[model samples]
Target: MDKNIVFLLNFKINKASSSRKRGSRLIQNLDSRLRGNDKRVKVKKRKKFVLLSLVFNYILFVIYRLSYAAKYLIN
Candidate 1:
């Protein structure tokens, strides 16, 4: 009877350990996915910022060129 009890306890312990390992693996996978998504969002935002700045700079350059031409024509 004692031997049977010991065997049952060992089995239970092994099953519990395996379940914990599986849970940890699931958590790690979710964390990695979230990190990847965050990186993508940051990259997209940076690209958008760069494009907007480029467009703003181009507009400023055109305005400056137009003013210069107007001054030359008036003179």
Candidate 2:
């Protein structure tokens, strides 16, 4: 009877350890996915910032040209 009890305890310990390993794997997968998503979002935001700066520079160029033309006409 004592041997049977020992065997049962060992089996339970093995099962519990396996389940813990599976849980750890699941958490790692979730963490990796979140990191990937964060990188994508950062890339998109940088692209948007670059596009906005380009547009602003174009507008400034146009304004400069218009002022220069007006000065020439006045002279």
- Per-candidate clashes come to 0, 0
Residues 1-75, model 1: lDDT tens digits: 368755755565565566887656555554555456655677899999999999999999999999999999999
Which stretches of candidate 2 lie above 4 Å from their native place?
Answer: 1-29, 32-37
Highest-scoring model, TM-score: 1
Candidate 1 local Cα displacement, residue 2, angstroms: 46
Q: Can you list the residue pairs that collide in candidate 1?
A: none
Q: Model 2 residue 2 lDDT? A: 62
User: What are the TM-scores, per candidate, against the unseen true structure?
Assistant: 0.55, 0.54
Candidate 2, run of 10 with poorest lDDT: 26-35
Model 2 clash pairs are none
